[model samples]
Target chain A: MVQLGRRYGTGPSSLAEIALDEDLPRAYLEQLVTSLRDAGLVVSTRGAHGGYELGAPPSEIRMSDVLRALEGPIAPMICATDDPAHLLGCDRSARCTVNVLWVRVRDAISGTLDSMTLADLVPARNITLDPRDPTASPAGVA
Target chain B: MVQLGRRYGTGPSSLAEIALDEDLPRAYLEQLVTSLRDAGLVVSTRGAHGGYELGAPPSEIRMSDVLRALEGPIAPMICATDDPAHLLGCDRSARCTVNVLWVRVRDAISGTLDSMTLADLVPARNITLDPRDPTASPAGVA
Candidate 1:
């Protein structure tokens, strides 16, 4: 998604190019791109010069959205799912004590992913260093 | 583990009692208890009065430790696993861009779980509220 977002408006990039560049399987990319297209995260063009591009701007696409498109909602456990449909089926939902912990975990993950955008992950962007790491250096500094 | 921790130092709680109280299957509990016993998280006694108890205090056992003992290391993906045995087999470990994202997610989850001890999950310790909803009440509060 980030790659598609980066190359957005430039031209459609083929799955072949993306798979080779990303070192991922072309077949996996085909399946994943189908999901992305269905989720409206990526738009596909069919022609000799056509391929795939982000459905929207890089800044408009959040990691959470991309993750959800690929893997469904960010559920650590089925019982901890945010979707009401999933929650309806858990027999122990009313009395499960540990479900709270799983929910918190799911939220923490969702929170982190939602906080990041495709723009933030784009290559050549500013490096984010850990403030607690005294030995850490900036991206380009020697 | 929570049940064992809750029953810590009181007396050995039988697998049957724990399974019944937790609404889990007895056979599943047996297998899980075996893992817990092997992991040294719980100690078992022999004979008719035999049962299990936490090897340590509730506060001494973190959720991260319990999860690791039960589910193995918390890897969001095989490529993101902290276990060297798993990492050694990943051919794309060197150049996978998204491995960084998975590692961050694993770290976030580990940080949350590691920060919490079994004591934290014990009912009636503290009320956890949903930060997103100002109107949200604590778990039991009206």
Candidate 2:
């Protein structure tokens, strides 16, 4: 996804190019892109120069949506799901105070996920730090 | 753990009792409790009336520690682990902005987990709500 984000405006990138750039198997990339396409996170073009591109700009794509598209609904436990469709509530919820704990946890996870976008992870938007210095912090970090 | 917390200071409760109360198999609960015991969250007594009990007050035990004990370290991704012993960092960390994203997510989860304790989940400390009413909120909820 990051790789795709980097090449967002360049044009549709072939799976072979992505695989080679990311040092992963082209077959694996193909499988992932299929789900991304189905989720409308990416769009595909067909022709001689056919390939895939982001469905929206990187800055507009929430990481939460990306993760959900790839991994299905966010669920920390079977009983605690963020999806309204699955909110039948757990059978033990009546007597289960633990349900609230998982709900809080799921909210924390979802909130964090919602707070960032693909742009936050794209190198162009991140403050570049000296790779060799683990303690180094950029003065201009915003 | 909640069972032991409820039974705290009362006396140790055997796994058989916990199994029946929680409607879980004794064998499964035994495995989970073993991890808890090794983490010093619970203590076991041996003899005719031997069983297990919380090692400390429920309020004193962080849910983060409980979860870490039952599971492993708090790691949203292999690149963003809380444990210093395993801080080799991913090879891609040098150029990977995604690391920070995972770190933020891990912190969100850990912060929420740390904010809660076992007492927060135990029924004795929770405001009892009407079991039949999903929308019902107790006036004394805190």
DockQ of each: 0.43, 0.67
- Among residues 3 or more apart in sequence or in different chains, the pairs in candidate 1 whose N, CA or C atoms overlap within 3 Å are none
Model 1 chain B poorest 10 in a row by lDDT: B124-133
Candidate 1 — what's its lDDT?
0.80
Best by DockQ: 2
lDDT of 1 at A91: 83
lDDT of 2 by residue, B1-142 (tens): 9888888877889999999988889999999999999999999998878899999999899999999999889998888888977766777667677888889989998999999999888875444376776655532344
Model 1 lDDT, residue B25, Cα: 93
Best by TM-score: 2
Model 2 lDDT, full chain set: 0.86
**Per-candidate clashes, comma-separated:** 0, 0
Q: Model 1, range B1-142, lDDT digits (tens) per residue?
A: 8788667778888888998999899899999888888988899998797999999988898888888888997898888786767674477655445676777888889888988888877765333466565754534465
> In model 1 chain A, which range of ten residues has the least summed lDDT?
A133-142
lDDT by residue (A64-100, candidate 1, tens digit) is: 8899888887799998776666664478766567887
By lDDT, the best candidate is 2
lDDT of 2 by residue, A24-93 (tens): 8999888888898999999999887889999999999999999988887888887889887877676777
